[model samples]
Target: MPDTLEPVRIASKIMKINHAGEFGAINIYRAQIMVARLFSPQLVATLEDFLSHEQKHLEIFGRILQSRGIARCKSFWLCGIGGFCLGLITALMGRAGIMTCTAAVETVVTHHLLAQLASLEAENDSEAYQAVQSILSEVLEHQQHGIEQSKDSLLFKPVSAVVSCATSAVIWLGFQL
Candidate 1:
């Protein structure tokens, strides 16, 4: 049997990836908040709110990992460092750039979460299903917020495309590891 076909194993893998992703998201918001304060103080509060949400998500996934005796994804640090760097670079570009990054990341993430939810349902894993479902609305809200904030920027399309590609690559790598 394939490793991915086993429900518990797949669910654990998904949780580990989600945990790492949430941690990465926290660092991204942290870096954004730090840099954005200088150029866009008004955005700091919004970023903080998002960061808080990510923290809750991280804790949720962490508890699941603990209960299942599953370790976090090996890519945890990679995601953190990469997310921070991405956040810093985008934040340097100012409010539009940061918003673009947020929109891009959340767009990719929302889709991934939906896919995970479907997989969990198919596996009949009620715990994972509930967890994923619980966060879906919030994730969609984040994406919508980013879209609304960045829609007027001329750089939105190109920046979002690049960041979305990068986000997709990171997610793919996380699953592989």
Candidate 2:
């Protein structure tokens, strides 16, 4: 790639990864909401609120990706299915399990966004850097929300580590994908 285009490529790649992640988040929340009826109304309300926030994040990232002309993942449907399966697995593990999973994923995403923000800052591309900063702020909010929601759960620690590791692995493979 040409030198000038390299940064744009990096930005676009980050955006693509973010877009996919946000989409997956939305799907996972959707699955949770679908299964919420089996649980309490209070739990359902919380999950619904989380889902709405994720939906907004998805919409924002989708617009950013589209405006940048980045093509969405060819396997997005498959990814959604995979996310649904993950949600189902968490659900089977119970409410605490599902909440832990959310916390874990959000923690990883927050760290990933931090790294992206650093890279964008280092690149000295103000526009892209600012965009990343904005994304990072939203990601931080999401992480905090997840933590607040899952604070009382015993599985939070283990779930956070496992999810952080899994998300990192997924992102590593994403570059090749």
Candidate 3:
């Protein structure tokens, strides 16, 4: 019989990819917040809080990547640039639009993290299982906060899917590049 280690390897790969993606998310939010401060100080402060949480998430995954000896994709630089560019564009779109973008990104990230957690559960990978559990909890907290904060806004349920799908597809392709 083939070793079950194969699934574990793939799981590790997913985890690393996820970690890199989280890093990109962090940078995107940071750029958005930076650009936001120019016109909307209060909103930028709010975004910064969630951005800090994402930074922590990135740290957790970075540790996991290091422990598993998983190297980040070389194309992650391109992904970062793409995320930064998206942030710049969103910022240019104005405060409401930026928050809408934030909500969209968080929603998709929450779903993706949940899926990764499910995969880890299926693999029964104890270490990765624990990591995913921790990370998902953190991500869910941010997701809930974003949803609540944006509930009455124009971005809550209206534009999240379209924006998220478009941005996520672009970012995913950026990683592949």
User: lDDT of each model, Cα atoms only?
Assistant: 0.89, 0.68, 0.68
Cα lDDT tens digits for candidate 1, 74-142: 999999999999999899989999999999999999888878877788898999888888888889889
User: What clash pairs does model 2 have?
Assistant: none
152-171: candidate 3 lDDT, tens digit per residue: 76654555676688656744
Q: After superposition, how far is residue 115 of candidate 1 from its true place, in Å?
A: 0.5
Off by over 4 Å in 3: 1-8, 151-159, 170-177
Q: What global local distance difference test value does model 2 have?
A: 0.68
Q: How far is candidate 1 from the true structure (C-alpha RMSD, Å)?
A: 2.7
In Å, residue 74's CA in model 1 sits off its true spot by 0.7
Off by over 4 Å in 2: 1-8, 149-152
Q: What is the TM-score of each candidate against the true structure?
A: 0.95, 0.81, 0.80
Predicted model with the maximum TM-score = 1
lDDT of 1 at 144: 95
Q: Name the candidate that leads on lDDT.
A: 1
RMSD of each: 2.7, 3.9, 4.4
